[model samples]
Target: MMPRPLLLGFLAIVVLAVLWISNPAVAFAAGLVIALWQKQVDLPHISTVSRYALQGGIVLLGFGIQASQLWTLTTQFAWIVTLYIGVVIILGLLGARLLRMAATEGQLITGGTAICGGTAVVTLAPIIGAKPAQTGAVLGIIFLLNAFALLSFPTIGQALDLNQTQFGLWAALAIHDTASVVATAQIYGDEAA
Candidate 1:
């Protein structure tokens, strides 16, 4: 293995590559591996950094929302939004039950699905007393789904020949995380929002 600092530097480069490739999920997983293998990088510090990123990410996420426009959207397509929320909730419940996950796992999964991603997961995981392994697995699953959403959602929009507005709505409703959703929306163009 390379020196710890060198390995850290290499991991940083890899992370940037993953981000550019729009596979932040892979970047996050790689980060975990590096921290585990090279304790000199400090697991706590890495975790703290990830938390800060999520916090900052969520704050940045607010920009994607348009409070004034939401009323119009709700009035125009209340049913669509309702159905989307319902499906997401149902699937989330089924996923947790089928996986035989703990209550906390269910909470974390649903919250992450319904709200933000890692931020929600991190906040609720401890509240529900989830097993570390279960929470870890849930986070991994969320990351993978987020990666798929970020990469494939644009293609899905194009393949379906969706209008920008339609694609934006779909991305916002279906994508697992705020950042991934916003990224997909942007892919459709600035007018998507």
Candidate 2:
């Protein structure tokens, strides 16, 4: 039998390969399971690899978006987006204060919720002087929410009988990460994506 670390490393590679081709929610769930099962296993460079994979996915998805459609949507809904972000940030900060959370942690979570999830949190963390642990905690929270959204949004859209356009808009507005939004929309159809 292979040494335990080697076996775990091989399993990680296979799972990542599968994840690259599989549906986003399924891939996330599979990774979660593997992580739980091998909590002690340490894979070097996995974080860097995953970060690159996520960036690549985002870039590839960008290629699929029509600039005309994006411009139209942005022009039509810019005010709504601004208002939503403002309200969410205000409420998030208030709630964090009420809960007596750290200021940096609260801001990180609030930014993640009000903006682009992990991207927002990561971008703000350094500027806000967030410690590594605080940033990690906020990221973990955002990731969990993202996972939940990935699994539930498509189902909810189907149950509501949302059309491709409606479902796509809803997912874009409601989901945290771009990856999650695209994945959930893709579940509805290509047009939704």
Work out the TM-score per prediction.
Answer: 0.64, 0.82
Off by over 4 Å in 1: 1-67, 74-83, 98-104
The alpha-carbon lDDT assigned to residue 79 of candidate 2 equals 90
Candidate with top lDDT is 2
Residue-level lDDT tens digits of model 1 in 45-161? 766886788679767766667887767777878888677777877888889899997767787888788767766788888787887887888889888887788677778889999
For candidate 2, write residues 93-182 as lDDT tens digits: 999999999899999999998898899999999999999999999999888888888899888888999999888878877778788888
* Model 1, position 88: C-alpha lDDT score: 73
In model 2, the runs with Cα more than 4 Å from the true position are 1-21, 40-42
Count clashing residue pairs per candidate. Answer: 0, 0
* Per-residue error (Å), model 1, residue 42: 7.4
Cα lDDT, model 1, residue 75: 88
